[model samples]
Target chain A: MVSLRTKGSFLKLYSWLPILILYISVLNEFDFNYLNLEYFSFNFPFILIFFFTLKDFKHFDYILVFIAGLFNDTVVGLPLGISSLSYILICTATAYLRNITIRPNPVKDWFYFLFIISLINSLNYTILTLFFSFDLILMSYLVNTFFTFSFYIIFVSLFKYYLKGLND
Target chain B: MASSRDDFIIAIRSAFLKKSTQQKFSLLTLVFFSLFIIILSSLDFKVIRYSKAVINELVYRSSFIVSVPENFIKDSFIQVKDYTNFFNKYKKNISELESLKSNYVSNEITEYENRELKELINDYVSSSNKILAKIIVDHDSPFLKSIIINKGSKDNIKIGTNIYDQSYLVGRVIELNYKTSRVLLLSDLNSNVPVTIAPQNIQAIVTGSGVDSGKIKYIKSGLSGQLIDDSIVYTSGTGAIFKSGVPIGKLKFFEENSTNEYKVEFYSDFSQLKYVFAEIITQTSILPTTQESNENSVEKNNPLDAKLKILEDELNIIEESNKKFQKENENLKSEINNLNYKVLNLNNKISSQNKTIDQFNLDTDELKFLRLNLTYGHKCRKSLFNNKGFIVGSAGYKDCVLRKGKIDG
Candidate 1:
């Protein structure tokens, strides 16, 4: 009986791992900057949120994603709600995509993610520069978008493995 | 076409309004909430500011807690890298240490002189205390370069407080919370510092290139040609935002598209900073306590108090210079007196030598007369039989005998 209870608790922990990872990524800023590569960075939270929300994972609540965005802004020392708005917009885009599609294709999803992140990053750049008067490098944003888009497929594959394990 | 348009409208409606079973708020509501927060944060409302500060305090603490594992891994990686290059780094550091030690004494004297001059110029004496702060979170974001430190308003850290890595200026505090603050590094794109390039003494502004170095901007057109590599860049303190003469970086030149571009390489590497010092400054005015009322009356009567103050400072400097000259004059007078005393002793010794030489000449003449008397006494000396001779002791007899016995004939 004790063994069965332990197994059930372990399964529950495993099921909640996606949200846990999301929180950890935002708080820890899980960009591998220790490599010391110039102009090398990717938004791990963006990839995580897009993949999980697109699949409509049961435990991946939109509210939690919103909170994670707040945490990200605080960690990155940006004005509050900038990242929260970005995260919510991503969820909205994914929700709209989920509604329109009868059969999901990874290639179409990938292209859609590219378009969504580009739009979102442009909006971020516009708001920060116009509203906050921030002097941000246009090249940094472009590079970040490119790398984030390119790394999506690799992260999607890893996330797929996690989801597959959860299904079992 | 009508069917596809209707489907699109239906999908859009669902995406905005629909909520999952586990979700509490619809996507549309969250979007509005985020927009409201953005507007509220920009407006500077008192309650909103307090709430934001509270959130920052909580979030920063939690982030520190969450970053520990990653920090450990990062520290381990850096430690391993450090070990790999230990010998080379040690060799370089030893050479640097030797040069730095030589500079240390002159630097201390200059610092003392600078302090005294500043005190003389400004009515208020500004004293600074640099408190140590640990960088709790250093997320090298692509857009913004900032670091969160474990010091804030509670530690007397205020907005615009200057931060340093050792003695080199690193950044300044922009946001302060209860126990944490954010430092906007000099490498951020938004950061601009008024600096003076040394040796040539060109005044210019340095703006960050969103990278490791800063770009020189707003300099005089022709003066750019005068800048050379390794020229020291230090704060000019023009706007009073930063302290004067704080070392910022060294000037570097790189060719971009066949055009010379100047950059500042900061002394402190922002990426490698683990601990920093946040300088807390306290200012005390030099108020006239003794004759306050009289000074106040004089200040009110004279519109030229500032000019009078300048003249008073000049007078004080002149008086100090006069005192130094007086002391030097006294020393020269004593030196002259000792020299005159030596000259008098030399004159006395010359007179004594002249007297001794006179006595020796008299004795030589006497000896010559005695020798002559022995040889020619029989021929010229006076006796009972010879009336032409005189006594030997007489002056004429001595002269006649010394003349080789020749008489008047």
Candidate 2:
């Protein structure tokens, strides 16, 4: 009976790992920036939000995701709510895609993710430049979008492994 | 077509309105809330500002706590890299330290003069207290190059407070919370500083290139031609945004596509900053009142005394150099005197040797005369029978002996 209770607590923590990782990513900004590679950055929160929201993960709360956006803005020194808006838009895009699809396909999902991230990045670039009068390099946003899109498949595979372990 | 349109509308509405069982808010509600927060953040409302400051205080602390492990890994990596080049860096630092030591006194003099000039121009005495602040978050974000320091309004850190790595200008504080402030680095695209390029004295604006360097802009036409590479760049204090004459970077000139490109390579590397100094300036107006007249009198005397002290220092330096030159001159004079004495001794020895040689020649001639007397002296003697003979003690007799008794006048 004691071992069973311990196992249940461990399972609960494991199930909430995505949101926990989301908060940590926003706070810590774990984007390999210390590598000092020029124009090399990817939005980890964007990928995490899109994937989990598309699958409709039980513990991945929309409110928590929005708060994570606020944390991201504080960390990155952006205007508040900008990242929150972007995250919510991603959640909406993934949600709409989830509702429309009858059968899931990873390749199709990958391409759609590319399209979605590209559109979001364009919107981000536009908003930052036009609204906030922020001086941002268009090439940096483009490169960031490209790298995030490329890395999605690899992270998705790992996320799939996590989900499989949860189901089992 | 109507059916397809209806299906699209249904999917869109579901995406916006539907919330999962565990979710507290729908996507549509979150979207509007984010928009509201964004607009609210832009406005200068006192309540919103206070709330934002509170949130910033909490978030910055949380971020600092969460970034500890990553910081450790990064610091370890940097330590390893630093160790690899430690010896070379030490050697370079030794050379730089020597040059800096030589320049230190002159630089102090220049600083004093500059302070006096600034006081004369501004009619106020501004005293700056530099508080050491630890960099809480240095993520090196590519979009906006900035760092969060662990000092803010509570520590008298204002919005445009000048941040520094040692004495070199790093950036200025852009956002100030209660205990944290964001410093916008000179490498950010939004950062622009008015600077004077040295040796040329040309004034221009330096804008960040969103990289580790800055671009020189707003230079007069044809003045760009006069710009030389490796010239110094420092703040001009124009617009009163930054303190004047603070060393910023070095001007690097390169030609691209037949056009000259100039970049200011900052002296302080933004990525490596772990701690910085935030200058808290307090200005005291020098306008004299009845109560402040005594203080004004003291202040007035201070500048004169300072000038006298500087002049005294200059005199001391000149005297020190003069003393060194005199000591060298005395040493050289003693060496020359010793050389002259040795030459005189040599001349005396040579004269004595020449005299000895003359004496040896005279002795050999006398011996020859004696040897000849045994054989030919009898025929050349005064009592001798031959009339062609020379006198016995005459100079002609000695000459005849040297000539082997051939008596010729």
Candidate 3:
């Protein structure tokens, strides 16, 4: 029942993409280790790519991106608000890419969003763990990564339906 | 369109000023987190784990529900611990029992002695007419100062039948059913017996304190002192309920006040009672009414006669002592009367002394008047008679004026 402007609608979904990712991943298992699973790295960047492929650089779009990433950090218990800022930068880059190039398939364009942001998340987790120096079992790291990716996939799939409705 | 954009920019700038949804959600989360921490700490899981005291289950609805899973989890863990402990204890008991069994030819000897003792008891009991039964351990009562015995109405262990231990009489069977009977300890609240102790031959009514110890109350209030240590209390058998010479308890201490009543601390350890037996003695013969009346009459008359004899002897003794008291009393009375007479004499002398003082005062007044009148006459003679040619007339007029002033004053 709620309507959004075409640009606003796309920006809103783009911003919530990371929240979707964190929800699916965190709910299944809340371990925030980055290098724990090799397979999870495959789907990780798809959500991040979704953010970077947005058409415009409206301040509101960047804000949504920031909020979504921050929410992901909260739900997944990642480093406090770092992801939100990284995600806003990712959104800016996607706007530039959209301005320069042809709009690609929704899946591939979105995969860039997933791939890049997850890479950033992984890097952040590694840096955080290095400082922490607590002994963690290898299985726990794998579980965290797998859950995070899986959580992202399910919420994004649901989010794609919202995106389709917005476009229509 | 320009105005809408300006408005939009204003809204965007002001967005940070508005409290964010994150702030509100974080507050809720903080509250929930605090609640979780309080619940965990307040439950005191460590105390519940280690404590031997019975655990209280229902602190609240959440705790009650929480405790179910917690108890189940703890139960399995504790079960293992208990099993290990039981195994260790079982091994220890087995070893000790084995060692005891190895050396103790005394056990066999005791068994043989027990059979022989039973034969001896049987022989004695046949002659004395008594029944002996082993104590059932499960029949003990934690709440009541009583116990149920194996023998009951079926065994003819009737009401008022005396129950005893290996060497001492314990109590009596008060309530009995067909197969089991409840015997009230002498320490029961409602239980009372008149006990006469050995050595001192002291008599006291021993009653239960509704606790483990029997109390001896109604000790002679006006009696100078209290129960001394190691005073053995025994059954007086006044109601014919207890056999005389049954050991009750030693006097621990007697607390007394102006009321003359005292509580006697008992030395009998009631808590560890292990073996007890009851003796069904025959019902005591109640005294006939005529005999009881005769005994009462004799008791009354005898006391009266003894008092009368004591009174007469006391009177006679008084008569002998009266000689001394009589002379002493008379002397005292006369001395009192003489003292009264002396007091009266002293009063009269005081009265006479007061009269003399009044006479002295009158003499002083007369002397003063004489001096005043002579001075006045001298002045009148000099001034009026010598200087004036009309001496008699001036002197008479001055004398008349002086007389008038004296009369007026």
Best by TM-score: 1
- For model 1, residues A78-105, the per-residue Cα lDDT tens digits are 8889999999999999999999999999
Candidate 1 differs from the real structure by a C-alpha RMSD in angstroms, to one decimal, of 11.3
TM-score of chain A of each: 0.97, 0.97, 0.46
TM-score of candidate 3 to 2 decimals: 0.27
Candidate order by DockQ, highest to lowest?
Answer: 2, 1, 3
How many steric clashes does model 1 contain?
A: 1
The Cα error of candidate 1 at residue B298, in Å, is: 4.7
Ranking by TM-score: 1, 2, 3
| CAPRI grade, predicted model 1 | medium
lDDT of 1: 0.90
Off by over 4 Å in 3: A1-168, B1-130, B134-143, B224-226, B254-268, B282-409
lDDT of 2 by residue, B135-156 (tens): 9988766699999999999999
Q: What is the TM-score of chain B alone in each candidate?
A: 0.76, 0.72, 0.35
| Candidate 2 overall lDDT versus native | 0.90
* Model 3 DockQ class: incorrect
What are the runs in model 1 whose C-alpha is more than 4 Å off? B289-409
* Range of the 10 consecutive residues with the lowest summed lDDT in candidate 2 chain B: B304-313
